[model samples]
Target chain A: MIPNTKTDPVIDVRDLKKVYHIGEIEVPALRGVNIQVQRGEVVAIMGPSGSGKSTLMNMIGCLDSPSDGVYILDGLQVSDLRDDELAEVRNKKIGFVFQKYNLLPRVSALENVELPMHYSDENSHMQQRATDALKAVGLEDRMRHKPNELSGGQQQRVAIARAIVNEPAIILADEPTGNLDSQAGKEIIDLLLGLNRERGTTLIIVTHDPDVSAAAQRVIHLRDGLIVGEGESR
Target chain B: MKLLQVLREAIRSINSNRTRSFLTILGIIIGVAAVIALMAAGQGAQASITGQIQSIGTNLIYVMPGNQLTTATNRRPLTLADSRALANKLRAPHIRNVAPVITDNNDVSYGKESLQTTVYGVEPGFEIVQNLSLSDGAFFTRAEIDSRASVVVLGPALADHIIGKHEGIIGMVVRINDYPFRVIGVTTSKGGSQFNNPDTFAYIPLTSMQARVKQDLSSGRVNYILLQAEDEESVKLAIDEAALVLRENHRLNLRQPDDFSITNQEDFLSIASSITGVLTIFLAGIAGISLLVGGIGIMNIMLVSVTERTSEIGLRKALGARKLDIMLQFLSESAMLSLIGGILGILIGWGLASLIGFVAAQSGTDLIPVVGWDAILLATLFSTAVGLFFGWYPASRAANLQPVEALRYE
Candidate 1:
C-alpha cells in the first residue's frame, strides 16, 4: 500500500469540460470542473438529478474522454487517451461498482469477481485470486451462487469484491447502496470504508443520501455540471 | 481476451435462450438440407439415364427420314431398299449390319387376355444390330422374313402380360389385329426408361407386317434404319458410309442436302446428360434462395439479441471490455449458431438422400442419390460465411454503444 501524503495526489483534474451533440443541439454535461484527491481518501460527490454527476463519474472512470481538460489519474494523463487505451487504463488502474450492483447476471459470484482480471494482463492464479477476493467480502461460501441467488447486501458485497479483485488504485462506486435497504446499505458502506482503511485504496462515492455523504472524509456537492461546494465531513 | 473465453461466453449466451436460438437457425438448416437433397436427386437422375443409354450398344447409329433440325417442305420416306444399299459390304465397309423397321400399334389377344402393343416389323438383322438376346426359343429366321411367314417373337414383358409365362408359350398362336401369328420366342427383359421401353413390343417379319397389317406393300417404306458399326472406332465412318449410300439411292446431287438425319449413341448420352445438368442447377438455385432467406433470419435474430443485451454490453464496457471484444462476442455467437445448424442439416440431408435412394430402388428404378463431400464442404463454408456476413451489422451496433448511455438504458 502506498502511504498517504499531501505531496502527490492520486487524482488531478483541471478545467475539465464535456459537451454532447444531440443532432443540431450542443448539450453541456460538464463545465470547467476541477478536483484533486489524495491517495486513500474517501470522497463523496452529492448532487440532485440533472446535475451531471454521472457524466463526472464517467470521466473519472475513464469510460469517456472529456471534450476539453487536463486530467491525470495515478500519474498518467488520460484526458487525451483513445477509447481502447482508456479501457486499458480503466482495466488496470480503476475499478467500478454500479448502483444496481452490476455483477453479470448469469455468472457465479467467483466468476463475477474474476471478470476484471480477464481484461487485465495478469494471467496467473486468477481463480485463486478471485476466490481470495470473495473471501475478503465475507461471501466465500456463496462463491458459486449467482447474483440473483444472493441477497441485496450479499450481491453488493460481491460487486465490491469484483471491484477490488484487480487491486486497482481507485474504486469508483456510483450509489453502491441505492438499491438496498437501510441496514444493507450501512453494511455496504462499512465494507467499502473498511477496504479503504485496510488497503489504502482511494474511494469516490456518488450519492444523494446525506448519511452516505456524512460517512465520507470529504464531500463535494455538484450542481449543473460544476462543483458548488466542498468541505470536510464529520 | 482469450479466444476460448470468448467462445465460452458465446455458447453460454446462446444456451440462455435455447428455443430462440434453435428457431433462428432453423432457416439455415432447411436451406442447407434442401440444397444437399436436391443436388443428390439431380445427380442420381443423370446417372440413371446415362447408365440406361450406355447399356444400349455404343457403336449403334440411327438414320431417320427427314432433316430433324430443319422445317423443310420436301421430305422422303426411308425404304428397305435404302437400308439394303447401306448394308452392302463393298460400298459401306464400316457398317456391320442394317435393320429396316416398320412399326404399327395393334391389339393382340391370347384366349381371354388382350392388350394394345406396338408391333415392330424388322428383318433378321435386327436381332444382331439391336444386341437383342432371347430368353426363350429362337428369333425368326431370314427364310421366315423372305417368305413373309406369320411367326412372331414377343418381348419378355409382352409375353408375360398375354400368356402369363414365357416357357412353353413359344408355340402358342396369338391374334395380332385379328390375324393369327405363332409366337416363336421372347426377348430378354431390358430395363426401360420413361422415354423408350422395348420390353412392351412384339417383333415379326417386315414383309408379314406390310402385307397383312399395313395392306400397303407398294411403297415398302420403313420407319427407321438401325445401323451397327464394326467397332466403336468406326461409328463416324459407318454414319458417313450409310449417308453416302442413302443419298446415292435417293438421287440427291452435290448441291442438295440429304432428306435424312443421323444420330449416334454418344449424341443421345450427351443430350441426356445436358438436360439433367440443367435440372440439377435449377433445383440448387431455388435451394440457394431459401438459404438467403435463412441468412436474413439470422440477421433479424442477431439484431434483436443486440438490443436485448444492451445493458450487458454497458456492463462489459464498464468492466474494461474493448469495442473489438464486444463485436467478436456477438459475431462468434452468430457463427456458432450457424455452424451447429449446418452440421445438423448435413446429417439430415444425408439421411434424406439415402431414403430417396431406398424408395427408388423399391420401385425398380436403379437410382442412388450421391451426396458428395464437395457438397457438404460447400454448404459448411456458405453457412459460416452467412453467419459472419449477417452478424456484422448487429455486432458493429453493439460495439458503438456508449457505456454511460447503455447503462442508463432501462
Candidate 2:
C-alpha cells in the first residue's frame, strides 16, 4: 500500500456545505466543513448533537451530495458526480458502518458480507472473498446465522466484515460503538485499529465516546457544522 | 447487477411474507378464472348449437310465416297448397321433399293416463324429410293420407307416456283432443337433446289433421313448410325456388317483402355462433374490469412493501445498488406474484368449466368445455402486463429513495 501523508490525503474536502429545503426555508446541515485524512490514518470526528457530523459523514460516504463543495475521493472529483456514478465510487472506494449495525435482517451473515461485491464488476470470487472477510471478523462459525440470530456485537462484526469485503480505500463508520456495551465497544475499536495498522486502510470514524476517540491517531472536533479544533492523539 | 440476482432477491423477499403475498394476488386469481370460465362456456355453447344444427341435416330449410326479425302477426300464413306447389319438379327441382307442417298443442289420453303434448300434422314424406326412423310400426302411407285415416304415429316418449311399453303400443288407440285415433308407429328415440325434442310429439297426416281437428281448414293455412334440399350444395337454389313459388301462390308484388322467411341450417349455425361470440366478449369485458381491480390491489400492496422496507432500500443503496437494480428487484416480485396467481387461475377455471360441462352432459346437452391454448397464452400475457403496469409506480418509488432520507426513516 502507498503511504499517504497530509499532502496526499485519500479524502480531500474544502468549504463543503449542504442546505436542505423545507418548502421556503433552507436548513444548512453542513456549513463549509473541510477535512483530510491520510492513508493508514485512524481519525475520529467528535461533535455534539445537531453539529452536522452525520451530515459530514453522509457527504464523505458519497450517500448525499453537497450544495456546494470541492470534494475529491482518492484523486477523483466526486462532489459533482451523478447519483449512479457516486454509487460506483462508493462501491469501489468507501465502506460504511452505521450505528445500528444495519445488516439485512433476512439474509445470512455470509450473504450480508457478499452484498457489496454484488455491485462490483470483479465479483467472480465473491463467495470466497466473503468467507475470508467473515473469518477476519472472527465470524467464520456464524456465517450461516442471520443478523437477528447473532448478538449485537456479532452483528456489528458482520457489518464490519461487509464493509471490508471489497477492500475499499476508506472505512466511514457512524457511531460504531453507540449501541454496544463497554466490552463490545472496546473489541470493536481494537478491531478497527488492527485493520488500519495491518491493511493500511484509512479510517474516518464519527463517535461520541472519548475512549474511542482517544484510541485514534488524530481527533477533529466539530460544532455548528464547522470544524472547531484538531490535534494529534496519544 | 445480474438479472438472476435481482430475481433471487425478489423471491427471497416475497418468500419472507408468504401469507400477505398470497392474499394480495387472490384478486388476480379470481379475475383470470372468471375470464377462462366464461370463454370456455361460450365456446361450448356454440359447439353445442352447431352440433344440433348438423344433427337436423345440413340440407334442410324451414319456410316459416312472417319475417324472422319481425312479428308474424297479420302476415299471410303458409299453406299446404304453397308446400305442394314448391314440390313440383319443374319449379323447384332442387327440393327433395316438401312436408306441410300443422302444429297444435293438445292433451292426448289413453285409459287413465294423459299427457300435454304437441300434435304435428305432416305429409307422408315427413319421416324421411325430418330424418326420423321408426322403432315399431310403419309410418302412414300416401293412401292413408288421402283417405284422411284416423291413424297416428307416436314418438317414443309420447307412446311411453300413453302406453307404458314400447313393444305392444303401436296398435293401441289414444285420444287426441278427445278424438280417438289408432297409433300405427312409434318413433325411435333421439337422445335427450336440448332443442327440438320430437320424441314428445305424435305425427298424423295433414289431411287427417285438417279434416278432423282444425276449424280453420277453409283458410288452407299450414303453420310452416319443411323442405329437404337435394344436398347442402342445393340449399340456396331450394330457398330461392321456394320463395318464388310461395310468392306466386300468395300473389305478392315484387316491391313488397315476402310474407314468410326462409331459414336454413347454416343460417341457424351462424346466428348461434355470433350470439355466443358476443356473449364471450361481454363476459370477458366484465372479467377485464375485475383484473384491473386486481392490478390496483397489487400496486397498493407493493407500495406498502416499499414503505415498510424503506431502511432496507437505503441499506441496499448504501451498498452501491443502482436505481435500476432496485426497480428490477421490486418489478420481479410483482411479476412473479401475478404469474403464479395466473397459473392457479387457469387450473381453477379448467376445473369449473369441466364441472359445467359435466352438468350439461348429464342433462343430455352436448356442451364440451374448451380451454384453448390461445386463451391460456392470452391470459399469461395479460397477467404479466398487469404485473408490470402495477409494479412500476411502487418500484420507482423505492428506486428514487434518497439513501440519507431512507436510512433516517423509522
Candidate 3:
C-alpha cells in the first residue's frame, strides 16, 4: 500500500497486476505494471492488440479493478475502492471518451454534454459550463442536433465536450477517433492538444495508431503486458 | 426547463418504439374497460329489479308455498279460509287490511290475439292492498265479487290487444276458462316483470273467479294472501301479528321455525343490493387481475427497452446521470403510457354503460348504469398505480447499470 503523502502523483502506479478469472482458468490481463504521471501531461500509451493497453486504461480510468495492485489516482488509492466511491471519483475527477463516439442517440448534443454536470457538486451554472465545453470543442453551433443527425466527427466532438463538461482534472480517451476518417481524427487530436495546452488538462490517449502516438509529447509503448519503451518523442 | 427536457426525452423514447408502446398499453385499456363494463351490467340488472319491486308497493306481501318448505306441502295449501281467519283475528292494532288471492294460469281471448296469462282473482280491497293502478275504469266492488259477478278487469297489454287501442268500453265481455266475463275496468300497464309478465294478466273478483274459473275451492286452497298496514310505521307489527296468527292456526310451534318465508321490501332490497355489490366487486376483481397482467406487460416492454438502449444508458451514466435521474425518466415514460390508456378506457366504459342504459329504457326497464365520477377516478388511479408498480423494477435496473459496461456493450 502506498502511504498517504503530500507528494503523490496525480496518477501513481506501482506493481499493478490485473487477473481475469473465468470459471477455473485465470487470465493475466496486466502483469506487474508500474508507472507515474505528474500533473498536466499529455501522455499516450501505445501498443498493438492484446498488449494489455486497454486493461491498463480500464484500471487508470477507474472503470474496473486490478486483482493485485495498488493504484493511487490523484492521491486516493483507487484499486480497492468500493463501487460508489469509484463512481464518485470517476464523476468528480476523471472524464472519459471512447472511439465509438458514445453520445446518447436520443438526446440533443447539448443535453448529452450537460448531463455529466448533473453528477457534479458544482452548482454554479450548468448551462454556462455546458456552453463553454461545446465552445472548447468548436461544435457549439450544432448543439441541438441528436447524435444520429450529426456526422461522425461532430458526434465525437460532442462526446469530448461531454467528457470535459464536469471540468475533471484528467481526460482519458480510448481510441477516441477510431471510428472517424483521417480529417476527423486529426481534428479530434488537435482538439485534445488544444485543451491540454490551454487549460493544462492532463490528457491520456490509449491507441495503437502512430499518428495518435506522434501527437503526444511522451509515448509509452507496451508489448505483451510489459512496457518495452518509455521516452520523450522526437 | 429540466422537467420539460425530461418529458421530451420520455416522449421521444416512446415515439421511437410506437408499436411496442401502443401494444403494451392495449392490455391495460382492455382490462380497465372490462372492469367498468362488467360492473355497469351488474348494477343495471340489480337496479332494474329493485325498481320493479318498489313500483308494485312495499306493503304487499306474497305468501307462496311449496318452494320454501317441501314438508309444508301436506299441511295445507295457502287458502282463502286462512286469509279470512287472519282477517277476523286481525284487529285494528294488529293489521289494517287483508285479502285472500286466488290465481291460475288461463288463456285470455283478446280479439284474435289470445295470449296465455296468469290471471289474478282479487277481493274489493285487494286493488288498494297491492297498489294496482286503475287507468280507464274502476275495479270490482264488494257487491260485484259477492254476487258472483262475471265482471273482469283486463291489464293494459290484454286491453291493447282486445280493444284495438280504442277508448275503453267499461262493460265488455272477455272469456276466461271458456266462460264469458264482463270487463268492468282496465288496469294501467305495470311494464314487463322479469319473473312474470304482469301486462298479459286479467283480474277478476275473488268469489266470481272461485265459483267459475276455479270451481274447486271447496278443497280449501288459495294462491297468495295480500296484506296492508294502517301506516308505513306499523308494517312490522302487522307482519308479526300475521306470523303469529298463521303459526297458531297451522298448529306449529313458534320454536320449530317458519315454514313460509315472509319477504318485505326491506328484506328484498337488502338481499338484492348485497348480491349486486358482491357480484360487481368480484367482476371488478377479475378485471383488476387483467390490469395486473397489463402492468406486467409494461415491465416486460421496459426491460426490452433497457436492453435495446444499452448504449444510451451507458452514455447517460457516463455523462453524470445519477441513479435517480435515469429511474425517474423511465418511470415517467411508463406512467404516461398507462395513464393515457386509463383515460381512453374510462371514456369507452362510460359510453358502453350509457348505451346499455339506452337499450334498457327502450325495453321499458328504465334503468341506468351508475357511471359516477367516483368510478372514473378510481379507474384512473388504479391504472396509474399499475404503471408505477410495473415501471419500478426496469427503471431501477436501468439506473443501476454501470456506465462503462453499458458503453462497451455492442
Candidate 4:
C-alpha cells in the first residue's frame, strides 16, 4: 500500500504475525502486533524472556519476514518484498549492533567497519566513509587491530563504527552493552545517544537493562506476542 | 559484490588456513601431474616411433616373408627373384631399386677385439632402398655382389667396435664368422632405427651371404625385400604392382590370402598412434579420479568452513549480503584452491616428465616427453570444473542459511 500525502512514519506495521514450526509443533512467536514510529524517534523495546521481543526486532530489522500482515519500512511494504529485496532494504535502511560485537575475528577493525559499506550503493568513497565512522567512534588508532587484539570496549566501538558507516536510516542495537562492564556499557550508550541527537537517526534498542531503557525517550514493553504497555522514560 | 572483491576474499580465506588448503588440494596436484606425465610419455613414444619409420626411407614399402597370423604351411619365404621381378618395368612400372636382404647373426673380430653383431647380405642398391649413406669410403659394388666378393661395409657402430677408431676404419680387415672381409665403407648411424638397426649391422653382398652365411636356404631365396617407389605419390601404385607380381610368382589364386605381407610407414604410423592414443586416454582417466577425489576433499573442507563460520555468514547477511554473494564467496574459495593446485601440478608434471626423459636418454632410450599447452589448459579447466561441481552443495548450503538461525548458532 502507498503512503498518502501525509508524511509517512519511517517504520509502520499493521497486524504483524509470526509462527515458528519445529517439526509438527506450532509455536506462535508473535500475533496481531501494530506499531509505527517517526523518522527521528528513539524507542527502546523491553520484555522478559519468551516475550517475542527478539522476533519483533527480527521483523523490524528485515532479518525475518512477518508471517502475515504488513510491515512498511521507509514507506515501502517490506512484508511483500522478496528475500534479496529485503536484504537491500536492510543494508540501505538499518544498522544493527549485536550484543557480542560480532566483528570478524581475523579481519582488521577498519576492514570490519568496511563490511557494511561494501553493500552500500556509494562504492567510490567507502574508505573515506569507513575512516570517518571509525574516527567518530574514537577507533582511529585501532583501525589496523583485529578483534582478538582489541579490548571488549574497542571491539564494540568497531561494531558501532561498522553500523553507522553506511549512514542507515535506523540503528537497531540488540543488547549493545550486554557483554561490557558498566563503564564500557555507559560509553556505548552515550555514543548511541550522541548519534541519535546529532544525526536524528531513528534508534530502537532491545534490552533487559533498565539503564538502557531509561536512556530511550520512549519505551515499548512486550508480553507474549503483543505490546502491553508504552511510556516515556525518565 | 564485485568479482575482484569476491576473489580477494576467497584468497584471503585460503591464505588464513594455508595448511588445510594445501592438504585439501594435494589430490588435485597429484592427479593433474600424473595425467600430464603419462600423456607426455605416450606422445613421446609415438613421435619416436614415427621418426624411426621415416628414417627407414622415403616412399619405401617393406615386404616381410610371412603373414603375422599365417601358419607354417601357408607361410612362404620371400626370394631375391621376387625382388628382382618387382624391379622389372613390365611387372611393376613405378618401382625403383629393390634390395633383397638375407640376415644372419655372426661374431665379428678385429685382431683380439670381437663383438656379436647381425650380418646382412644385401644387394648393392641396399644403400638407396634402406636410406643408408656412406660416412667413409664406399659401399660394395654390384660387381662385388656378382663375384660374391669378400668386401663388406661396416655399420658405424660396428666399425667403432672392431677398430676402436673412426679414422683408420675404412681399410681395416675384419673376420665375419672366421671369413676375412675387407672394410670397404661405414654407413651413417640412424638412432632408434626399428626394422634394421643401421648402426649395428655388417653389410656384405647378397650372394656371399646366401652361399657362406646361410648355406641351408636355396640360392634364389632371401628373408625380406625393400622396395623403393619413384616418389611418395606413386607408393600405392608401386605397392599394388609388387603385390600382383609376388602373388603371380607364388601361384596364389584370387580366393587365397597372400603368403607375404607388404606394409608402409603410414600403416605402421596409424597402428602405433592409435595404441598410444588409447593408452593416453586411459592414463588420463586414472589421473582424473584423483582430481575428483581432490574436489570432494575441497567440498568437505568447505562444508566444515561454512559450519565453523556460521556466525560470520549470519553477520554478513545481516549487513546486507544476498544469497548470491554468500554462494559466490564459498564457490570462489574452492575454485581458488583448485586453480592454484592445477597451476602447481603443471609445473610439477613438466619438471618430472623432463626428468624422466633425461633419465631415459642417459640409458640410451631416446625418449623425449612433451608437456603441451593443451594438457595444461585442459587440466586448468577440468580442475575449475571440479571445484564448481563439488563446491556446489556446500556453497548452496551456506547461501540458503536463514540469517536469524545462523546468527543464533553457537
Candidate 5:
C-alpha cells in the first residue's frame, strides 16, 4: 500500500443523504454517510443488495446530487452545484467504468477513449492523447476495434482507457469485472492496479467481490445506507 | 462538442437504420415535390395563355358594347360610327388604326367540303390591327367595303381544312351561309388549339356581311371595334381616348356610365396573372399541409429513437455530455434528414414538371413548366424548419433524462 503522502484528502464527504420519491413513498437510498480518501489511494466499497453502495458511487462520481450533505472533491465544494456544473465536474475531474464496459457499441476503441476529451476544455492533440491512453491500457493493437469485436477483458481495458483519457483526478469504477470470466477479471484487475501504481490515479471501486477488495489499498463496508466498517488492506 | 463530430455521429445513427430513415423522410419528399410540380404547372398555364393573347397583336385594345360589370340586358350595340370616330387622328392621336368587326357562325363550303366556322366581317384595317399576314393572295380592298362586294379571306387553318391547301386557292368561291364569296387571301398560321384557334376563321367585307348574310344593314351596328395604338407605351392613352370618343358618340353625360368598355392588353395580362397567382398559392398551401404531416412523421420517429437509445443517452451523460449537447445531436439528425429529402424532392419535382411540359407539347399545347428558384428555396427552408420545430419535443425528452434511471433502464 502507498503511504498517505498528501496533507489534504482528495475526497471529503459529511452527512451525505439521498431520498427518492416514487409517487407517495419516500425511499432513502443514502442516509447520513461520510467518507474521506487521500490522493493516489485505491479504495473498494463492498455491500450486498440495498446497501446504498450504488447511490454512494453515484454521489462520488457527480452523476447525481445528494439530498443533503457536504461533498468536497479535490477541495472544490460540489454538494450544491447545479446539473450543468455537475456535468462539468464529471467531465474534468471524475471518470467512470462499468461492469458491462460502457464503451459506445459502434465506435472504435480510440474514439471511445476520446469521448471525455470531446467534452473537455482540451481541444488540441485529442487523437494523440486518445492513442496514448489506449496504449497505456495495452489496447494499442486494437485501437480501431469496436467494443463488440473485443473480448470481455479487452472491452474492459478499452473502458479503462476511456476513463483515464482526460487524466481525471478520480476513476469511479462500479462492478468493473462482474461481467468477465475469472481469468479475464484477473487481467482487468491487474491492469487497473497497474494504473494505480504507475500513474497514482485515484481509484474508488464499488464491488461485491472479495478478490477485488483484497487488491485495493483499503476496503469500505456499507449496510442499510450507511458505512458499517473500513480497514487498510495489504 | 464540435459541429462536425455531432453531424458525423448523427449520420452514423441514421445510417444504422437505413430503411426506417428513408420511410420517415418519404412524407417530406412527396410534399416538397408536389409543391414544386404544381407551382410549375400553374406558372406554365399562365405563361401559355398570356403568350397566346400577346401573339394576337401588340398595343391592341378592344371596344365592346355593354356594362361588363353589371347585369344589364338592354345594352346598346357598338356602331361603325364609333369605329370611325376612334379612327380620327385629331380626336384620338394615340389611336393608330381602327377595324370594325362583326362575327357570325355560318356554314362555309368550298367544293363539297362544308364546315360550320366563324365568319368575321371586317374592314381593310383589320389585317394590320389584328396582326394578320397573308400566306397567299391578298386582302380585300376598301372598294369592296364601299361597293358591298362579295370578297373573302380565309385563315390558314380554315383554308387547309375547306380547300385542302392555301396554294392555288385564291379566287376559289366558298359559300358562306349558302352565299358565294370569292376567297381573296389566306392568313398565316398562328398556331393554336382547336378550341380557341384564331387560324380557323373566314374574313369578308363588313358591308357584304351586313347586306348579304345578316341582312342587318339598316341597323348600322358592328359587333366590336379593334384599335391599335401607335406603340405599347400609348396603349393606355389610346384606351382612354377611345372611351371619351365613344361616350360622346353615344351621348352619355357624366351622370350615365359609358355604353362601351375599352380594354387594353395590360388589363388582360394582369387579370390572367392574378388568377394564376391565386391558383399557385392554393396549390402550395395544400402541399404545405402534407409537409406538416411529414414533420409529424419525423417527430414520431425521433420519439422512438430517443426511447430506443435511452441507455446511450445515459452513457453520454456519464461521459460528461451536457443536456444541450444531447439535444443538439438529435435535432441535427432530424434536420439533416429533412434537408436531404428536400434536395431529392427538388430533383424529382423538376422531372415531374418537365414530363408535364413534354406531354402538353405532344398534344399541341405550348406549355413549359417553370420551376422557379423561389419554390425551391421556400421548400428547403420550410422543411428544415419543420424538422427543427417538430424535433424540439423529442430532443428535449432525451436531454432531460436522468443518468441514473437511464443507465438502469433495460
Candidate 6:
C-alpha cells in the first residue's frame, strides 16, 4: 500500500470489501469497491434490488465497517475504528436521514431535531439553533406535533431538520423518499436539493428510483457490489 | 449524564404502565407489612408483661419452698415466728411490708355448686405484695387475722365464683370446711404478674386457714413468705435481712444450704424480656424471606419489560442515549416501585398493630401489640435493597444491548 495523498477527500473508500458469512455459506455485500467523494459534492449511488446498495449505504453511514479496505470519512480512517470511535464519527461528522423518518414517537418535532444537537459539543443557545433548523426545513408551524400526527412529507422534513441541525460535513439520506407517495417524495427531494444548494453540504443518496438519481449532479450505478457505470445528471 | 432527567424518564415509564407497576409493587407491600407488624407486636407483648410485674409492687420479692413439684426439700417453708420476727424487728428502709401465708386445697360448698379452691391464709399487708386494691368491700384487719376469725378476701375470680355481684357481697357468707365465712373484701381484677395468674384464689387469715383447712399443720406452719422492699434498690438489704432472720429461726450454720429461693420483680421481668426478644427476632428473620421473593418478582417483571421494549431501547440508543443513562433509568423505576410499596406497608403494619392492641385490651387478655421504630426502619431498608439488588441485573442487561440487534429484534 502506497502512502495516501495529502489532498484527501471528505470520504475516501479504496477497494473496500464486506463479506457476510453464515456457517458454510458466504455472502459478499461489497466486492472490492473503490469510490471517493470530495467536499461539497452532491453524489448519488443508484442500484436495483439485491445490488448491495443498502450495504454500501450502511458502510458509508459509518453504521458498519468495510471487511477489508480503508474508509476515511472526514480524514479519519474508519475501517478499523472501535465502537466508541465509530460512534464519535457518526455523531460528529456524518448526519443521517432515514426513509422511515425515525423521529422518536413520543417526542415532538422540535425535540426530535433538538435531540441530536443535545449530544453535540455545541453547548450554548442549542434551542435557538434547533428552532432555526426546523424553520429552515419550513416546518416551524408544526414544531410541537409528534411524528405520528404529522403527514409523510412533514415527518420527512422533520427528519431533514434533525440531520442538518448538527452542522455535520456530510448528509447521508438512504431512500429518504421511499415510504412517501410521489408528491410527498417530490417535496422531500426538493427539500434535500435546497439544503445542498444553500449550505453547500455534501449529499449522498442511495436509491433505486431513476428519477431520484436524475435529481443528483453525479450518479453512480452499482451491480453485484461493484460500480458498473457513472454518468452526469441530465 | 443528567440524573434528574434519567429519573424523570423512569417516572414516565411507571406512569405509562400503571397497572403493571402496581402489580409488581404488591408483593413487596405484603412482605414488608408482615415483618413490621409481627415484630412490633412481639416487643409490645414483652413490655406489657413487664408492666404487669411492676404493678404487682416493684419493691416485692418472692420466696418459694421447692425447686420442683416433687419433695426436693432442701428449702424450708416459712414459719409464723420468722414472719413475726422480720415484721417486728426489721429496720424501716429494708422492710415496708411482710406477710406469712399458709395455702392448702379445700372444698367450698355454696349450695349445689361446690368447687375445690386453694385457700390462702394471709394478713392485711398481703395486698401490698400481691398488688391488690379492692373493687368493693374492705379487707380483714389485723385483729381479724390474729383472732382466727372466719373471714375471707375474695380475688376477682373467686368473687365471681362464690358470689354474683360486687354490690353488697362484703357481708355475704360462704361455707369453707362446713364453717361459715364472711366475705370481707373483693379484689380488683389484676392480670398475671410475670406470666403467673394473680386472681386464681381467695385470701384468708393465717390462723383461720390453718384451723379450718390445714389442721394437721402446727401453729408455726406457713407455706410461703411474701416481702416488699421500700424501692427497687433496697431489695438487696431486704433480702439480706430476711435471710438472716430465717437462718437464726431455723438455727442453721453457713455449711447448710439456703432454705428458700428469693426472686425480685426485676429478675422476673428481665427473663420475660429475653424470651420475647428472641421470639421477635426469629419471626422477623423468617418474614424477611418473603421480601426476597418479592425482589425476585420485581426482577422477573423488569426482565420481561426489557424484552417487550426491545425496539424502544434501540430507538433510544440510536437517538444518542449513553449506556449509564439507560441503566439509571430502569434502576430508578424499580426503586420507586418498591420504596413506595414499603411506605404503604409501614402504614398498613401500624394500623393492624394498633387494632390488635385495642382488641386484646378490650377482651381482658394480657397480650399487647405495638409497632417498634427499629422494625419499621429495618423493613424499609430491606425492601429498598431488594429493589436495588434484583433490579440491577435486568437494568444492566437492558443498557448493554447492541442497538443493531435490538433494532432487528422482532
lDDT of 4: 0.88
Model 6 Cα lDDT, one tens digit per residue, B45-120: 8888777667777778876654443444355667887788878644334877888888877766556555577788
List, residue by residue over B1-410, the lDDT tens digit for candidate 3: 15666777778888887888889898899888877877887777778778777776776655654446546534546777668766874332556678788888888775565767888888888878777787888898989877989988888777777666524667777788888888888787777754577766788988878888889766557777877766767778778777777776677774565555555666787787888889889988998899899999999998998888888877666555667778888898898889877888887887888888888889866677877676778889999999988999999999888766887888
Against the unseen true structure, what C-alpha lDDT does each candidate score? 0.89, 0.88, 0.80, 0.88, 0.89, 0.79
Off by over 4 Å in 2: A4-9, B30-50, B65-98, B104-117, B146-148, B160-167, B175-180, B189-197, B214-222, B229-260, B273-297, B349-385
Compared with the true structure, what per-residue lDDT tens digits does model 4 show for residues A1-234?
Answer: 122335778889899999999999999999889889888788999999999999999999999988898999887889978888988998989999999999988889998998986766677777788899999999898899999999998899999999998888899999999999999999999999998887878899999999999999889999999999999997
lDDT winner between 4 and 6, please give it: 4
Error of 1 at B269 (Å): 3.4
Model 6 C-alpha lDDT per residue in residues A1-234, reported as the tens digit of each score:
122244568889999899988999999988988888877777889988778887888788776777898888888888997655565667677778877777777778987788775455564677788899999999999998999899989999998988888778789988888999998898899888888878867899988887888899889899999999888887
- For residues B1-410, write the lDDT of model 4, one tens digit per residue: 88888999899999999999999999889988887888788778878877777777659889988777655356667887788798899889998888888888888889998878889999878888887888888988879889999888887777777788755577778898788898888887765455455687898998888777778887689888988999999999999998999999888888778789899867877887888888788888988888888888989999999999999999999999999999999999999899998988888989889988999999999689989888989999999998988899999999999999899889
Q: Between which residue pairs do clashes occur in model 4?
A: none
Error of 6 at B409 (Å): 3.4
Worst 10-residue lDDT window, candidate 3 chain B: B65-74
Candidate 3 residue pairs in backbone clash: A116-B319
The total of clashing pairs for model 3 equals: 1
TM-score of each: 0.83, 0.85, 0.83, 0.85, 0.92, 0.80
lDDT of 4 at B80: 73
Q: DockQ, per-model, please?
A: 0.59, 0.64, 0.34, 0.67, 0.71, 0.25
User: DockQ score for model 1, please?
Assistant: 0.59
Interface RMSD values for all candidates: 1.0, 0.8, 3.2, 0.8, 0.9, 2.7
Cα misplacement distance, residue A39 of candidate 4 (Å): 1.7
* Cα lDDT, model 1, residue B401: 96
In order of TM-score, best first, we have 5, 2, 4, 3, 1, 6
